[model samples]
Target: MIVYEVFRQERKGQAFAHAGSVGAPDAAFAEAYAREQYGRRGESVALWVVPREAVAEIHEFVDELQKNYHRVDGYPLKEKLKEARERAGTAPPADR
Candidate 1:
């Protein structure tokens, strides 16, 4: 038996999401199984059945530069806020 991946679209003009998988001997049976499993209740407007071997899996991502500016901790917001408050004479007493 060959494994087939099923994608389902719940509404017209919408993107298809990964529904599940079905194992069958051929494409026709795989499609039928997918229809019975995913579309029997009319939950999916459309179905796409593709052999699992045709799909590619991506596991590795490269980020060699170590860029951090987009993260919140990358900016010294607390220090900058303190400096701004001091300059504006709105800083609270250090005892607090």
Candidate 2:
């Protein structure tokens, strides 16, 4: 089996994110291949090469139910704001 790891630099000072993976024969091949695949048209600033065996893959997520509490959009703010405005009696125009 052949495997290749790719690390991409999103922007200055930003750590590279493991965008995805591909299969290749060796390190040199992976580097030559990845530079083109990831940086083609200069989309990325940098990349790292690693063998398939050297990389660990995480494929499983432990979420067994809804986990909205960890999300910002989880809490409905518009309705709460409207209720607060009504209670405070300081609501402004719809356009404002």
Candidate 3:
């Protein structure tokens, strides 16, 4: 038996998400099984039954180098905003 991935669109104009998987002998069987499992209630607008072998899996997601600039803490927006306000002669009045 071949494993298949099932993707379903809940409604028109919406993105499709992974619904589940089905094990079958071929594409025809996979499609029928996916339809029966996910679309029997008429809730799915569309379905895509793709073989597991056709899908690519990513196993490694490690970032070898540390890049602090990619995070929010690396952005010093307050200082930049203060400089811009100063340059525009719109600095907030000195606190009383």
Worst 10 residues of 2 by lDDT: 19-28
Candidate models: Cα lDDT each: 0.94, 0.80, 0.93
- Give the residue spans of candidate 2 off by over 4 A: 57-96
TM-score to true structure, per model: 0.68, 0.53, 0.76
lDDT of 2: 0.80
lDDT by residue for model 1 (14-63), tens: 99999999999999999899999999998999999999999999998775
Could you tell me the TM-score of candidate 1?
A: 0.68
Best by TM-score: 3
> Between prediction 1 and prediction 3, which has the larger TM-score?
3
lDDT-better candidate, 1 vs 3: 1
> What's model 2's lDDT at 87?
89
TM-score of model number 3: 0.76
Number of clashes in every candidate structure? 0, 0, 0
lDDT (10s digit) by residue, model 3, range 1-96: 999999999999899999989999999999999989999999899998999999999999776676768888778899999999999999999795
Q: Tell me, by lDDT, which candidate is best.
A: 1
What residue runs in model 1 are displaced by over 4 Å at the alpha carbon?
A: 12-15, 70-73, 91-96
